[model samples]
Target: MNNLKYSICYISFFFLFMLSMVNFMMMIHFIMNNMVIFLEWEIISLNSTMIIMSILLDWMSLLFMMFVFLISSVVIYYSKSYMSSELNLSRFIILVLLFVSSMMLLIISPNIISILLGWDGLGLVSYLLVIYYQNLKSYNAGMLTALSNRIGDVLILMVVSWMLNYGSWNYIFYLEFMKNDWEMKMISSMIILAAMTKSAQIPFSSWLPAAMAAPTPVSALVHSSTLVTAGVYLLNRFNYLLVDTLPLKILLLMSGLTMFMAGISANYEFDLKKIIALSTLSQLGLMMSILSMGLPDLAFFHLLTHAMFKALLFMCAGVIIHLMSDMQDIRFMGGISIYIPLTSLCMNISNMALCGVPFLAGFYSKDLILEMVSFSNLNLMVFFLYYISTGLTMFYTIRLTMYLMVNDFNLISVYNLYDEDYIMLKSMFILLLMSVVSGSFLSWMVFSYPYMIYLPFNLKMMVIYVSLMGGLLGYLISNMMIHSMNKFIQTYNLSSFLSLMWFMPNLSTYGLSYYFLNFGQNLLKIMDMGWSEIYGGYGMMKIVKKYSIFHGVFEMNNLKIYLFSFILWMFFVLLMLMM
Candidate 1:
């Protein structure tokens, strides 16, 4: 069994890597020639309607596919060792392959129906992955993850129905037309709602952290490239429908709030995985908000770059979690850099990339995003959201770093901590190298011309300034102690509200589920068991019983009734003879 799992992992890794390389070459060729290939196969046609499956091969789709394959390859290779002890490792690798296939389908498809095929595939497979542990927490988290993505799936179905007006499911052709038609706005709105749910934007945001219940490899893949980014990719494809629209405005606000919310929530979180999950949420917000601002290129660029470092970060965290016997709280983790220097080095580099530190992978995209935000004619509220969220990102990154690498050891005495797993280290090294260079490499490849940033000195220095302040604040906050009184205790309500994701999890899970379940209970009682049963079934039975009793009484007087009936029969015979 172990040999089979190993063989499966190696086979998957090799296949995915070769595919990634091929896609990369194809992407470069497409970019150089400025070409797009659209292949459509018609399945059925009735009157004005046609059912056609489509695959769109453009630079964007190819590039995204390349990244997806690259990440999946490394993650699968990494998992060979990471999941070596599990009996069901082969099943896990197969599921991961299924997930990658789903993502690829989503990337290449132009038809809404085909997109939904991949979309639903991703949601279902992710739920299965999330619940792989077969425990209560995993079950609950899987439920949340599945249900959240289900909303997006429903919206996509609605989109498919709405697109029927055009007699085609190839929505790519009709995007420009959708922008002008008020009737078509409904489709766009539904699409945005779908994207929001899949991306875990505000109100639907609670499930991202909950999804950490999945194994670390799953988390690294899902959060970094495949699951959460599906929505962003969808919107990126549908960018034309969102230009200068109300849905775009709403998306902008929601995404900005999402960014801010995730940043603040991460600071208050202590669970290492949850913190990283929140950081993914935060970066997703960045991608979405930038996308909403009408720069799909920047959004796509960030999405690609973010994928590199974010996956590396999760891989590093996985190694630590594995070594620590599945302990995730950062409080119990301190100064393990002394023991696992290589892992620590990777983690710190990834963290710096996350903070958008200069010259790193994150910096290339993030700095450009900030500079663009400054360059655009935007309101103070939008401006504040952009910069403050940037700062909060750095703040959490520093705090997390300090806790893991700077503070003294707080775990049980005599814990084995080493970076000796060559498989895991090799996989991480692939991402670490990408995390260092992919940003600049993608920046040059993706953009035809560099964005000219003509900003004042103060405006140009804004990111740096905010980053410094945030880093200092993180250090101070991490070092500070409450000897006299606990401030969190003093401000219990505020702290709880902030720490609990503004009670979103409660609102999403209990608040909505309780009321709906209660309503359903009432419906079941009143409709199914009460009125329906009584009036439809029980009442009819009672009437039949009462009639039967009345007939029984008549039967009791059968002799007299028979004599009367004989006379009546004779009268009826005489009447028939006269006729």
Candidate 2:
């Protein structure tokens, strides 16, 4: 099959899939036997301590490794057709493999020091991938992504330093001890901060949306499954120490606000990738919030399930973008289903799953998460945020669907519609199946006993009510037209603020850099060009010249100069003796 050469990634995909399957079985066996297998190598030894490279082969790490491999394999196979036109196909595939390897490193390591190796690898490789297009937009997005992730890198390095005090860098062993110590609590706070940045929580969120400048497959892999989830995975690991703490409560507040913010922003978004990016942000906030509520298992459950559907969603978007000549504006897309029905089917399924439609992938995790939030002792603000965010998710999904699937096609010609790309379709089908089945599969595997969420009639129906209202509003908003074309001018400022993510991009970029840049400019002016020139270098030359000129005058063969020099020398000698 020479055709298989074009899809070389499929070979790698199958190989990785087999490895993942094996790991899954091993993990299950370990879980069943109540055992953990750790492999350690003492790389270096200090007095009474060792710098160790350790692999943690337990249910959690193995399970996550299996998922990572599963997703990466599917992504690689998907990329074969997606990037078929590119000249440097091998480079792209290599980057994807490197990314997968780094993710694996991150998954298996229990030591903080070893974890940094993987964490920084992800940041570095993702930066490269984001800039793969070599355009100005991609460059800017790459810088933002790298810098945002670099903050986490620095934090993890600090964590490594903190772990040094315990004479061991293995945080897996120290989480319990660290939970009780005040000093260790500070360390835990840093870890949470690192997680927040990686997860794009609150202030660190500007980069995630900006990173949509990359190719869609990179977005699918990095944003959906790997890079962003690293933070949640880290927090999942540290959930024991974080439970019921003030830091975790802060996480809850920020995460809830982030969820609400991204949801609202997605409604205002027009770009296809950006809307999905915001949706991912919203989902991440949901995961972080659930984890903050002391439900790491629920958070992890949502994390894995979200990875499946969101990746599928991005792949579908990629297919649409390719079909429409790289057009990513939903406003420019309408009635796409009439052309590419299969892709549209996958898109709708993913969208419905995103909205937590009952029995879909999102429902099992999202509904459980929301119900758990309701059962917890939460304030009215958080309560409203959780429900409203859920509604906003549906709002954006319905609005997106209206723009892409229901409205009339806006293209100049109908002949441009060609959807039969079996290569792309095949990869999408793989994820489509997972998006439908992964939720039920994970729910069964992760929980031995079913959770009974007992609520009153009104409370039980809260999610459905919000979801229905959200859908209705989305349809109305998408269809509604203004009496005057300039009607939006009245609310332009408010809309712009919400649409621009509260100017967070500006804040993260120019706002953060303004002072340092200003100070540098001032130093260049006053120190380098002004003061140094006047006093240090040029000024010293001027003083020396003046003294030399005076000395020449004094040494000149003139009677007046000789008398003046003698009088000055006599006066100087008398003054020196008096002193």
Candidate 3:
């Protein structure tokens, strides 16, 4: 049975890898030839309306599909070892396959209705995956994840209904024509809102971290390529409608705040997976803000490159967690590099890539994004948000590295930690290779010409400067200790706010629902148990009882009442006859 489960994983890994290769080649072909193929299947036609399913085969979709398949393939292979002891490993693998298929459906779709099919599939499957552990935390996280994405699903449905104006569901064809119209603005606004919910910008950001209840393999696929990126991908496709629009401007501000907020939040985070999840959130903000700047291509570039390293980072974290007896807190982890050198090496590489170290995968894209930010005529607030967020990226990365690699081992004295699991190591190595080379490869393939960036020397060095300062702070802060008292207690409120993602989780869950729940309780008291009960069931019972009492009185006096009535009738009849 275990062998059969393993075989299922291996077979999935093989086919997905082959598909990724094919998609990669096709993406290159489409890019070189500047071609787009739209295949439409008409499901129904009524009057002047048509419900057609349209598939868009372009370089962008193909490239994204390739990356999705590649990461999914690696994640599945890694899960075989990660979940080897589980009795229901086959169920896990099947869910992952379903997720990948849904993502593919989303990528190929150019119609709103079809997109919703894929969109809702992602939400539902993700909810299932999040609660895979069948624990309280997993259940709560799954509900949060599902409900948050449901907002997006609803927005998409609204867009579908609004698109009925065109008598067709193929939104790609109407993007330009609808750009200047009021209805188009409404549609675009809804689309942006939907995307924001899925990508988890600002108010919607809580679910991404909560979703860490999912298995690490799911995190690797969902956070890195498929689920979170779906929103960004949708926005990128609709970039034309967003140019010089109010919704785009608001998205810019929200995404910037989201990036900065996540970076700050990650620094204060202790959980290994949550910190990584927060970093994913931060990178997502960067992609969104860039896309909002009217450079969807650059956003797409960063998205692809980010996927390579972020997935690798999660895989490394997974391996470490597995070996550490499921210990996720960084405070209990240190100097594991001495015990498991290969995993540490992979972890360090991925972390550096995440921090945008020179010449690595992230540098090619992140550095370009910073330079582009400098080139654009943006305000100081936006400027600082971008640079500071970059620094915070380095800050958390350095702190995380120190905690896991540099410091002394703070866990049990006697334990075995070895990097002998080749199945897991092999999967990590594939992503490790991609994390090193994918940036430059994608830079060359995606863009025909390099961006022309011109900036002053100070602005040019801003990213490096902020990064160095952030790294320095990270090192110093991690080394400091508070004697005789907990440091967080000294600044309880500030620490609470920062560590808790600015109370976003609280606001999203309790804060938003508190009033509604309170109102519901009031309704139950005043309606269901109060006026409603009186006028409804309780009142009807009272009326029925009163009638029953009146009937009982009549029955008790029945003979006396009958004799009196007969005497009155006889006297009245005699009087009438004499008249």
Candidate 4:
């Protein structure tokens, strides 16, 4: 009964999910058997809609749903132990259910408005999950991720406004408008920017790693499975419409570069989950690049394989942390194999798949991308940009496995891993099994033989073995040179790379978070130019504080004048927004 907290969470979620699962299958059956129809078309407002339409489920969307459900169920079960010791476990389950519902709705939403609605709710709900810990840093990270995604929300709103201005909120009508109206294309570019930022490509990448402040299961939810995947899911669904856009080109380049940078960053991280966080960022970048390159099914496939394998990996890391007094640093763990054999096996296998090793989930999906990129219409430079990052996945995976479980004599034995609670082990075992099977299931669905990232992954040599071998050899050589006890090692090649990749962004975040200052040039610029500066008052503000003029102006006998002036300004801004 001491574990009743988690029990209730599991049962409530399982029951709720079972109900939703039935609905999901019912939806599939309905969609397969008959056309879904909406009746009564008489909407006269922006927020309300009425139209008769049917959304056909393509293989891509159906596959994404399969991942969506599979991941949600796995995370919930994993959460039972991942959040076992925390308070509000039951409420966490409720929120998890809400998040799942919102994501599923986002996937199946036939209209942009409904998608936006689901997206908005998902933001709020996911923010709630991130800040659930209420640790000060978690609060900040959650707020930042929510805020960046809000920028995306604003972009989406811009698209919505443009659509409304063009006559109606119809997606079909908007696409038709794109064929002729430059404004429609501009609006779509804005939407693509929103999607890119929301998915954390390059400069928008900070928030996701910061999101590591959440509990492991929440991190798994955000990184491995649900909310963040929303962006890729949308892109995959809308790929047909988006392929010809210039933003698709920009996305391809940016997302590919992001993949490279993120994989490099993963090498610098020492925190167990932070490594996974960086890896997830890199993986998302890869998925986005593939989607941008006109491979929606491949992107969806990557998402599926990534979610399963990454969830298992996170759960394995969660186990180590859970058992070891919350010691999350890689420096603290060596010979974890001696303590947690089950966890070590899970981690090893999952990492192999992640590193693109043979017969694992990450292998097939990633191979498809490699094949596409290798054969893409794009030039060699762009193709190799992503390919380089794919190789880095192998590097970082080896680094993780070597640092955590591959060392010599055991140093730490702080907990009885085998005697660990059933709930945790059971939760993990479920994910491990799925991780083992997802690779094969996905291959069958895609009608391709499983190709490994390593030698002899399958009965038939479907993978490009020479490329895989070349990547491995290059990785081994780099590892040796970087770790060798020579002049270069003394100068510290690996540490320098780590500093540049891992510590620089953290430093920049600190540097850029200072109070804004743009006063002297502002008043003239504000009046002469239309761009208003929201910067701090600087010397003027300091002078006001020193002289007490600030209080006097607002609290003096001239307060009514001030109030009237403020009202007039508010009215002016409103006038501009309307314009």
Candidate 5:
């Protein structure tokens, strides 16, 4: 029975993937001819749009799905053993299939409603799987993660509402709307708020670290490579919508803030998995900023390259924890190069890729993003700021690589290489291979027509040189600083001014619902405390939670408050109904 279920997932995955692949080939053929389908047909609503099934075939959609399939397949195979001691195998496999299906659907969705449905569905499956452990911490983290996603959804829904009313329900309609309207600015702003929340952007990012409660395979599959990137994916999917709007500028601001903070968080985080998790947040922010600039091609390339190195890194981290009695703290891991030579080798290469060493995969993709930022004609000052942040990314990436592979600190016994897992090694090496050449391949494609898209190769080389040097310098600083101080570089909290250091975007069970409630509580206190001083010239004002007319009105839960909000919305609904 277990074999039957396992076979079912593998079969379904391949079949759907092939179907999407064929659809994509057809789409590219259509796109080259500038064909546009009317996404909706009342006769059957059966418009076969290219974007609708791009999950397997469209250049942008297919690129991301490649990462999805690569990591997810290995995860399933790895899980065959990882879950060997567990019961409920079928249930787990089913959820994994559902999760993959949702992501594929999202990638190819031709319309906004379809995309949102897929987005919400993916979040639900991820939440279910995240709590797969059902331990106290896992359950808490799952519930918290779910709440954060819901908050993001709320922001998206708000934008959808505005677009449908002021713009149009169809996503393709944004191009037309942008030509004649300003309302898209508000819609874009709202949509990006949703994006930030989904990507685990700053202040809202704690859910990702908490998400480490799930199995490592899930970490590599859902959290790192696929679902967490959905928000950025959406932003890129509609790159044209933000082309030259104020919302695009706002997105740039959010991107810078998120990347800077995420890098800092990664710097100080102690857990191996959490460090990667934080790094995912930081990199996704960098990706989002790049996407916000209307550089779809660059964003897609980065997505592909990041998946290769990140998966390799996480798989190695999994092996590290497994061997050291599930030791996840970086402090507890050192001199690891001795025992697991194969893993050490893979980790060393993967670390180099992450640090953007030239000739490595990261060097190309990350360098393209920075070079583009340096040269975009419209925003000179903004590009300069982004360039500076790229330098920050360089510093942190070097810090991480040095701590894992080269440092003389925290020496410990290294176990023998875990060659029992050949698939794991193969997966890591495949990514490493791609990491080395993806940039070159992408560069060749772009430079195919130099007059049309002239890449500043000379300038690009200089930037790469500077980026690599920055990483080396940062690594050296950590090395010398560590030996002299005899302590971890993170001990001093070098990035304390980043206020997000102390706050979690969605820390506990209480989320926006709690925030709104607290807002009301404070407002009521302000009125109660100040009313007597203003009205009667200073008798005491009671501090009380007891029922008063205004207190009752103010203390209603989110539902009733929403109910009253519905009354205001009724005016609009009735107005529409009357019209």
Candidate 6:
């Protein structure tokens, strides 16, 4: 049965791979001619407005779908090995397929109503995937993932309700016409809110790392590529409506801060998967920041390249985790390249790409984004956040590399670690190849004209200076002898704060809900156990019993005789009056 399932997945991957290639060719043709194709079928009509199913096929959508399909295919192929020992391998594959379908739905739909189907689908399927292991950790992570995304889901539904004012659910048609409309502007704010939750920006950022509780392939496909990117893609589509708005500016500030915070958190992180997950968060912040800066194209460009390398990075982590008997701490993993050289090679390449090494997949997009930010007239804070975030990115990447590849082997001596699995390597190599070439390829294909960055010399070389400093610091700090670390015990609070992501995990998970949980407990005590008992069943019973006792007492006192005599006298008086 497992063999049959694997075969089916492989066939589907091959089919999608060929389809993406053809779609890419068609997208090129459409771009060359500046053409667009739209298809719609009406679902319902209310007065002058019609709710309809709609799909827009343009170069952007085509290219995005191409990447999505490619990544999904690779992730599915990779999962065959990763999930081979699981009893429910088929279930995992189906969930992944469903996730891909939802992502595709989101990509193609321009109609707000139609997009909900896809949006909700992604959320539901992701929750299921997150809890696939059925463990307590997976269960908690799944709930957090679902509820976090539900905020965006509710926002999208609200946006749909607001779209009724424009008499159409097709937001694409009305973006330009409703650009300055107060109602539309309000809708745009809600849309940004929705995007923030989906993209893991700011307060909504905690879910992304917690979601690493999912299987590694799910993390590769969903967290790294498809699911988290949904928000950026939505904002990219809705960029026209966000022009010069306060919400957009707020998005800029929050996303920039997210970029900085996530990078700092990654440097302090020790969990192998989580460190990579935090990097994904940082990249998402970069994309959101760029989108907020009115360059959705650049954001989308980074999105694609990031999808490639980040997915590859996660897959490499999966290989390591699988080999190490699920030990994810980087402290226990050193000189890993000695055994799993190919996996290490892929890891280094992806990490370097993540750091935006020259001519790599991440470089073209990240470099452009930094240069564009430098060129723009921005305040000191946003500017420094960009460069500092970039530097922090390199810092974490180097630190992670040093811990994994160069530090002493801290393993229990009995285990075997080797890159013997060809299946995992094959899946990883596909992404490795793409991560190496995709950035330069995308820069050429997406941007017909290069950005002419104008900045002073020091400002122009800012990324370089910060990156070099970051590299030096990463090496020095990561390589420091362990016993000497006691000197900084006084700064334990500050170090703990950074290590725990400013206590954000606590803030988002327990902090946000601790009051509610405490309130619930109090309510249970006062209402359910106390007041309700007194006021409801017990009180009613008491009243009934008291009346019964009074009646019994009255009967015991022979009150029925007095009651009969009084009634007879009243009846006689009434009879006499009638006569």
Best candidate (score: TM-score): 1
lDDT values for all models = 0.92, 0.89, 0.93, 0.71, 0.68, 0.90
How does each model score on TM-score? 0.93, 0.88, 0.90, 0.78, 0.75, 0.90
Which prediction has the highest lDDT against the true structure?
3
Cα lDDT of model 6 by residue, 86-130, tens digit:
877777888888998999999999999878999999999999999
Tens-digit per-residue lDDT, 281-391, candidate 1: 999999999999999999999999999999999999999999998899999999989999999999999999999988899999999999999999879999999899999
lDDT of 2: 0.89
Cα displacement (angstroms), candidate 2, residue 371, comes to 0.7
**Candidate 5 local distance difference test against the native:** 0.68
Which is better, 2 or 3, measured by TM-score? 3
> lDDT: which is higher, 5 or 6?
6
Of candidates 2 and 1, the better by TM-score: 1
Cα lDDT for residue 86, candidate 1: 90
- Worst-scoring 10-residue span by lDDT in model 6: 481-490
Write the residue-wise lDDT of candidate 4 on 384-495 in tens digits: 6766786677767777777787654333644455536666677677667777778777676655445333333341233344336535544554346545533443356766
What is the overall TM-score of model 4 with all chains considered together?
A: 0.78
Error of 3 at 519 (Å): 5.0
Candidate RMSDs in Å, in order, are 3.1, 5.5, 4.2, 10.5, 12.9, 4.1
lDDT of 2 by residue, 1-579 (tens): 335545677777888789879988987897778788889999999897799999988887888888787878877788888888877777787898899899888888988887899999999999999999999999988988898898899999998887778888888887776677987888889999999999999999999999998878889988777999999998998887887789899999999999999998998999999999999999999999989989999999999899989999999999999888888888888998888999999999999999999888999999999999999999999999999999999989999999999997875575477777887888899889989998998898788789999999999899999999999878878886433523562278988899988889899888865566678999999999999999997999999999999889867789998888789999999999999
Write candidate 3's Cα lDDT for 259-347 as tens digits.
Answer: 99999999889999999999999999999999999999999999999999999999999989988899999999999899899999999
* Model 6 misplacement above 4 A: 47-49, 481-490, 517-579
Check candidate 1 and list the clashing pairs. none
